[model samples]
Target: MTVLLRSSTTLAALLLLLPKTFVLGSVKLVMQNGGASQCQTLWAKHTIAVGNVCVEADQRNPEQLIVSYETRDGWKLDDAHLWIGRNISEIPFMADEPADDSKRSVQQQQHQDQPYQKQQQVDLTQFPYKKEDLAGKHENFGFVVKLQHLGYSCPDTQAFVAAAHATVTARSSIRNGNTPTLQSAWASHIEPMKKHVLQGATMINRINQWQDFNFTLVCDIKNDPPEGAPKRHFANQVPK
Candidate 1:
């Protein structure tokens, strides 16, 4: 009877020591500046064939920011959250871009014509990417978000930054009955991750410690286009 009682106590102790939560796999963040051109340059410099993520200004509309990611085998990008503003705190509360491109163009024009207002006027903008958007393009995929739509105007001399939070899941994790749902996991981790970024935590350090990944890219939007680049035009302006 004594031996059985000891065994029961030992089992209880082990259960107490077990972690309360579990993660199916690692999530990595890779942010490259200057959009596609910058990504290409980094690949050549590092002698790598491809990159995990790329950020670039839209070719037709410089004010629009495009974020691209590479699809990986055996893993799926369950959730991707993005925020952009003068700083980290300002990002989460920024306004979301309109779903329709035409509507966004009109919004941009209105934003430009109006005088600049305080950041508090903008609403919380959710990350724009959805998993279905990447359908069929197994190799890679991308999405665009306009800065003007987010309440940032062009011709402003200040520099702004963008933060991307991606939650990836291993196929095996999904199959495991013990794993928590993606929604629950996101709810548990999002605030803490934001706190880490606000504190200026090193991403490599976090990755080594098996934490969620966060990355940022600095962007400088200028009033004048770069030399030899296409002239800037408003979305509403039609060519004669």
Candidate 2:
């Protein structure tokens, strides 16, 4: 079973470790020239995968927001989870540290030393969805929720955080039919695995394979003035 948890400090550190000239899949992270109504773009970083993320206020309804994620060739996204709040720590999935202290330390050191390793490793035990829920379903990858939905509103500025994870597979492994579906394995193993982890299981018999793309974007909301409001006029231009 693959288990993964990242503390907020680690997430912040990873963000800093990313290259200043990082390139997203198809979209580049650059300043948007249009007004607040325009879509804002951000870069997502991972060891083996690249992602492009976008957030924008819906043109049809300013109160709604649209968030989208895209990946480059040779990689497919399995699932994505989003959290909106004032800070990254507010995200539940990112707030928890690994239960094992030694493992955490080693993993942290490895990541710090080699931030861009070619091999992809992801932990999806905490993720809620099954593969069938997202695989091959293009629309499920993006989110379209109201600004005020679930009491999260775009008052002035808010942080939009996303965690997207997927598994990397080789054609030879699949041709041999030795590869197992992550969700299937997760479904059958999670319960027992949880017990084992809580009991301090330390077996590392299989190679853990998964990739995570994480990013954050700050959104600024600009609402038009209310209708029927009195207009301001210069003293010289007043009705005379």
Candidate 3:
């Protein structure tokens, strides 16, 4: 009777191990551009494996993403500020602060002495909003939001203050329909913010990875006259 009971349990377990089939479907890539797909190529180059799908892109020459759009009234963007961020780790420990010898290991000292540098790359397509969306909270601000790094000089508090002034000036210029020459000029202003105590700059215990800092910036766009401008159409610095 014990042997028979054991046999019955084994059969029940085997029955529970039956195979289940799943329906398979393929999703085609709707290439927005006629040529080879840039997103597909980037995913392939990165080999950033996802679920069961594989993507590929040109390994040698990669295309950059540039943002261009038209407004309802047919206003086209010839050029706009492409927000960028710097990898703060790009700077060497010795370069940021040479006196802190206790923290810089032997390997770090060697690396600091070398001339290796990190490249600055921007992902313009990875924008904050859908490519086609015309209305949103972000749209109201008339500025694009992005993760960017700005360059800064250490031991320079006044430089940081200057950055703030530059940012406000650029935004004001954009609103007034004046031509803004350089995007990096504005980025330089924000560079000091990363080192600013408020941004949380931390040193890693390891030697390979340098300290990392993140920053965000928004573009400004408004044409309405200021409240205090001498002319009704122009807004003066003073509030009306």
Listed in order, each prediction's TM-score against the native is 0.36, 0.41, 0.18
Candidate 1: tens digits of C-alpha lDDT, residues 1-240: 000101012234333443333211111112332123223211211222222555555556544556665535444455444454565454434454344434333334345444322223222235444443322224455668765565543112233454443444445555686563322112111233222211222221121111122223221211234459876668999866
lDDT of each: 0.36, 0.35, 0.23
Estimate, for each residue in 1-240, the C-alpha lDDT of model 3 and write its tens digit: 000101012233332343222111111111223222211100101121111111112223221122222122112222222322343332222223234455554445555653323223332344232232322112111232211122321111111111100111133345678864322112120112222111123332321111121222111111234458666433546655
RMSD of 2: 14.7
Instruction: Supply candidate 3's per-residue lDDT for 159.
Output: 11
- Of 1 and 2, the candidate ahead on lDDT is 1
CA error at residue 125 for candidate 1, angstroms = 8.4
The count of backbone overlaps in candidate 3 is 13
Task: List candidate 2 segments past 4 Å from native.
Answer: 1-45, 94-132, 136-140, 150-155, 158-240
Q: Sorted on lDDT, highest at the top, how do the candidates line up?
A: 1, 2, 3
- TM-score pick, better of 1 and 2: 2
* Candidate 3, superposed: residue stretches over 4 Å from native: 1-115, 128-139, 142-178, 181-191, 194-240
